[model samples]
Target: MERTLVMGILNITPDSFADGGKFFSFENAIERAKEMISEGVDIIDVGGESTRPGAARVTEQEEIERVVPVVTELVSIGANVSIDTMRSKTAEAAIGAGAKYVNDVSGGLADEKMAKLISRNPNVQYVCMHWRGHSNQMQLKAEYEDVVKDVKKELDERVAQLLKSKVSSDQIILELA
Candidate 1:
């Protein structure tokens, strides 16, 4: 039987909707990751940026500074880690630091180079989540006639783009959220 894997979110951001800055500090983020592992989480998804509505985008350098160290610490502690980032640069940095997955909520749309980056790192897994737009403007773009159909179509398109970019099908994981 196939068992469901439990993935825990570890937001290393000051304005995360889930944790509300509880894990923003480096030490706090690492502690939370360890706690999640002890609590039976199979994967720790580390996100440095907040996607909360009307949230301003953080600089790439800031995001890298926020995420890479946490990912490295989690990997050193034998935890399976996924970098939750839209920018390819951040994902590349995290992967270099030993993260095994790239969780892009934008389905590779936010960053044009995301697919190419994932393609080059064939060992890394990519989470292509369905995103209508950025948090600040997504609600305004949510007027789909057939939500399910539209979402499916969009995801398919993304998968095709990824394939064209040479990212293997096995490396891609489709996420509705």
Candidate 2:
């Protein structure tokens, strides 16, 4: 049987769905990453934005500032890190800071540059999730003839775009969550 790799979640924002405000501080976030590493986590997903319903949108600069430091610190400590963000700028900063992956919940809908960015960074893994829109109004946009078929179709289209942009299949990680 194939072993399932564990990816630890590190929310550095004050309004995440769960564990918000728990590791909002840089020091706290680092500690949590360390703990996860010690507990055998294969990857650490660091997020700076809160995508809950009605959550406020953070500026790109704010997201960059909130995540780069933590990502840098985590990578320095030898933890495999992934940046949980949708914006290309944020993903670039995180990759520059040593993150190995981009976990974009918007599936590239939120940022036009995302697919191209992932394509450019051929070594970085890209996690594209099933998303209709941003969290603030995604639920309202969830209409579909067949949920399963529609989601697969959407993801396939996004994947095709990524491929056209030169992203390798090995570097793409589809996220159903």
Candidate 3:
């Protein structure tokens, strides 16, 4: 039997719908990550941006500052860390800080450079999520005759694009959300 991997979310944003502001501080975020690891989480996904509907966008620098430290600390503690971000710059910073995965909710659509970044860092795993748009406007673009078929088609297109950008197929992980 295949073991199910449990990924715990460590949102260090002030506006996330779940646990917003709870882990905004460095100490709180580190504590939460430690708690998740102690609870048997296979991976801790660290996010600095709030993807909640109508959530305000944060600057790239701010996002880096928010997550890189926590990611570095988690990795030092021997926890597998995944950076939950759509921006390539933020992903790059997190990867530099020792994150092993990039959980991009935008599926490499939001930022044109994301695929290239992933390609450059061949060892880092990439989580490509099916996304219609940003959280604030994604609902408006959710109209589909057959949701499953449409999502599959979109994901296939994304995969093709990532391949064209030189991202290895083996490094890609598909996510329906």
lDDT of 3 at 5: 92
Model 3, residue 152: distance off in Å is: 0.5
- The TM-score values for the models, in the order shown, are 0.98, 0.96, 0.97
On TM-score, the leading prediction is 1
Q: What is the C-alpha lDDT of each candidate?
A: 0.93, 0.91, 0.94
Query: Which rank order by TM-score, best down to worst?
Result: 1, 3, 2
Against the true structure, candidate 3 reaches a TM-score of 0.97
Worst 10 residues of 2 by lDDT: 130-139
Question: Cα deviation of 28 in candidate 2 (Å)?
Answer: 0.7
What C-alpha lDDT, on a 0 to 100 scale, does residue 87 get in candidate 3?
100
Worst 10 residues of 1 by lDDT: 47-56
Backbone clash total for model 3 is 0
Check candidate 3 and list the clashing pairs.
none
Compared with the true structure, what per-residue lDDT tens digits does model 1 show for residues 25-46?
A: 9999988888889999999999
Q: Report clash pairs, candidate 2.
A: none
